[model samples]
Target: MRFIFLVLLALSIALGLGGWSAHWALDQSAEIGTVTIGPWVANPSAGAPDADPYSKARLAKIGNLTLGLGEGVQFTADRDAAGRPLRRECQYRLAGQTPAARVWTIAPYSQEGRLIQPGSGRVAWLTSNNLMRAEDNSFAIAVGPRARAGNWLATAGTGPLVLSLSLYDTPVSAASGVANVELPELTLESCPDA
Candidate 1:
């Protein structure tokens, strides 16, 4: 009887642990084939055929199409360079030199993966063609509630902010086995409550 009870208890514990692990694997923090640069993270195999089960599950749960290996790569940032959570009430300056890509785009989205609506007549995204370059060939984009003159990503939503940078037709995907690519710098400028 003692032997049987111990076996049952161990089985129950194993099952519980398995269930919990599955749940956690589907959470927001769950990612496979990911690379981190500062506050940004890139899942180069997000849309690849060899994607792990967690990445496949995440992509299916989000219901969004990811770029394929030859298509491009996407990097997401949920915090600033100072390691502070990005908030809609705060302004940020995203500046840096991007890697070699035919075209790129930066956009702000809510935590739910929905694109934040831009202000009246203003865009919520910046494309490679419309970006302004500094003397050193670095670019900057403003992000906040208020509209700015240069490239801007309007944070008109009411939730935590997330920035997505997409590089189209770039040689940075996982298939190429290239890592440590140059990304942008996300600096917190100011905040209304600050």
Candidate 2:
């Protein structure tokens, strides 16, 4: 009787731990094959045919179609350069140059992966071609609920935000590996309540 009870307790504990681990792994955003630069993170193998089983499973759960190996690479930032969470109520500025890509796009999204809608007659996303650059070819974009002069990416509502930067037809997606390239810097300027 004593031996049977001990065996049953051990089995129950093992099953519980296994279930919890599986759930945690699936819910995590960053997994193996992920590269981090400042606040941005990218998984180069996310859309590859030879990706790991865990990565493939996570992508399937999200139902997001990642760029193919030759298509491009997508980087996401949920925080500013100082590692502070990006909030819609706070204003921010993205300044600098992107990697060597033929075309790129930047946009803000909610935590749930939905695009944050901007004010009427305002744009929600900014592409590389339509931006206004400085003399040195650098660009700056103001982000918040209020309007600003020069290039602006208007965001609405209140809550945490995520920024997506997609580089299309860039050599960073080559078969060799992800190159060490510099992405734009996101800095928090101010908040209305602060």
> How does model 1 fare in lDDT?
0.85
lDDT of all predictions, in order shown? Answer: 0.85, 0.88
* Tens-digit per-residue lDDT, 1-194, candidate 1: 99999999999999999988877868855755788888888898778888888888888877888998889999999999989899988889998899989999998888878888866786878899888889998988888987788777787855699999999988787756546787889999898777
Residue 41 of model 1 has an lDDT of 88
Residue runs of model 1 more than 4 Å from their true location after superposition = 1-21, 175-178
What's the TM-score of each model vs. the native?
A: 0.84, 0.85
In model 1, pairs of residues that clash are: none
Pairs of colliding residues, candidate 2: none
